[model samples]
Target: MRELSFHGVTVRFGAGRSALAAVDGVDLTVPAGSVVGLVGESGSGKSTLAKAAVGLVPTTDGEIRLDGAPLRARRDRRRLQMVFQDPYASLDPRMTIGASIAEAVPGRPGRTGRAAEVARLLELVDLDPSRAGSLPSGLSGGQRQRVALARALAAEPDVVLADEITSALDVSVQGSVLNLVRDLRRQLGLTMLFISHNLAVVRYVSDVIAVMYLGRIVEAGPAAEVLTSPRHPYTRTLLDAAPRFGVALDDPVPADSELLDDEPPSPHDPPPGCRFHRRCPIGPLTVPERTVCVEKDPQPAAADRPHRAACHFASDAAPASLEVPAR
Candidate 1:
């Protein structure tokens, strides 16, 4: 496995004056043989950052490195692989699962040898080797997803970029897929960047987690620490919005909370200072010391604890400030 690092990476689209920064100044690292979860709502630029890591999207500034070496213009295709969100969309409709997996395998193999390799790949993902003859449409969502995963692993990649791979699955199936990924990481010692909007899913599979908002990472640290004692208000809000299994859908939400309510500011023209200030429940409009949230942009700074947060008031607020209100 290899360490993956992003140093001040930025991705922008369109021309000068009309340019929109999709991913802005992201600095993150995934240690060798570990999973780092990146979580955010839609349009938070997490997916764009993932694309930049895999060279699908161009970075306008800074660099991405594997094992401290700067990624080159041309890279080994087998060293990194990306598993996209939609399994159905990612698979080839015309080909059998075996054929697709064999196509992605690294190196030349004769017809008979490649088929054996494909069976092994399928087994690695907990799929039956006999399914190799099945078309993508013939398999269930979970089975098709595992096939997609198997195809990615055929390259024997050092790093896997999994972008919301389980978001579309049923609850029971989601657990199985999550478990498959965890088991694969342990068995293969794989390094991974798992991106998702589902905080609960990320919390289950990640060793460390990064919370993104408006094209920037607002907080990052050990998964337990970041989730339970989140320093950033945005991080807290996300946790609050994640539905509790036993809680009724019609249960009254906290009236004064800043969660699951406001939409994020438009990325096309992000606000000055803190991009979250407009929707921040504890900003200048609500709290006395939070005036700085509207006056200046806060950089990711070390908090009182192990993690880092971009909010100026992070140090002042207690983690329990975000506790879900009793229904």
Candidate 2:
């Protein structure tokens, strides 16, 4: 059912001495019309993967495939769109929001249909097309973010990679934008890779969730299952970090009670075994899953059938700790 796939994808940067691996070999499948959430703390390589998917960063290794065809082979730039975290920064200051959105469209056809598309986008994100002429500086944070979404839509891409699209806005304003994306997903039958560090945000919009730690997906499953019953220590740490009204998920208070704090190891000097073992709380792993699980990486293991976690004790590992009351 997944339409997008990643095969052993890896991305490194800098020269020989300064080279750093940002996203290590990561394999994933994203279903069409499904919102797959990618969550991790800052520098966890979540953004890097998103950038790599859109070819923003040259891959150090691995391959990306869309619709069963190789994505790395072709330069079908318009087929996939990217919406970055900082809406204000991603947009152009000189261009009207309309022109910004229209730019993604190409040729005379794009020029003509641009008006109707803009109107539809405004309604989709709850913005007035009349504001198309407004500058990014004039718009509120939320409005500017919505404009970013509208611009990405202009391409009519089959898949949209949204990296922390809401982190830059007020909490209240975030809900509306998320709902709009969900609504657009239904209307367009799109395949979205919605990346966010906030588990709560990912839970709200994603159909499936992939928990990323140090550039690897340690746990993945239905949003509810992973959120309610995670099997990976890192996943537990993430869920515990979320602030639910009644639940006590409270992640171990950070140094300053920062919640989650394990500076990702330098990819160039990643730990010999298990890049996450340094921060992971669970002790289960498969020989191959952890083949290098200790000094190697693990593969996603089936837990509750379709649900998966990459741990040797996938079958028996206790669910990650959370503050939510057991219902």
Candidate 1 lDDT tens digits, 1-327: 899999999999998778889988988999999999999989999999988877888899989999998887566434889999999999999999999999998789999999999999999999999999999999999999999999999988889999999998898999999999999998999899999999999999999999999889888999988877888877877776777788775554332464437777788889888888777766765665667787798874534434678887677556656444332
Error of 1 at 286 (Å): 1.0
Please provide, for model 2 over 56-169, each residue's C-alpha lDDT reduced to its tens digit, 9 standing for 90 to 100.
888889888888777854456457789988998999999888888877765555555888777778777789989977888999988998888888877778789998889988
lDDT for residue 38 in candidate 2, whole number 0-100: 90
Candidate 1, superposed: residue stretches over 4 Å from native = 245-260, 300-306, 322-327
Please name the candidate that would achieve the greatest TM-score relative to the true structure: 1
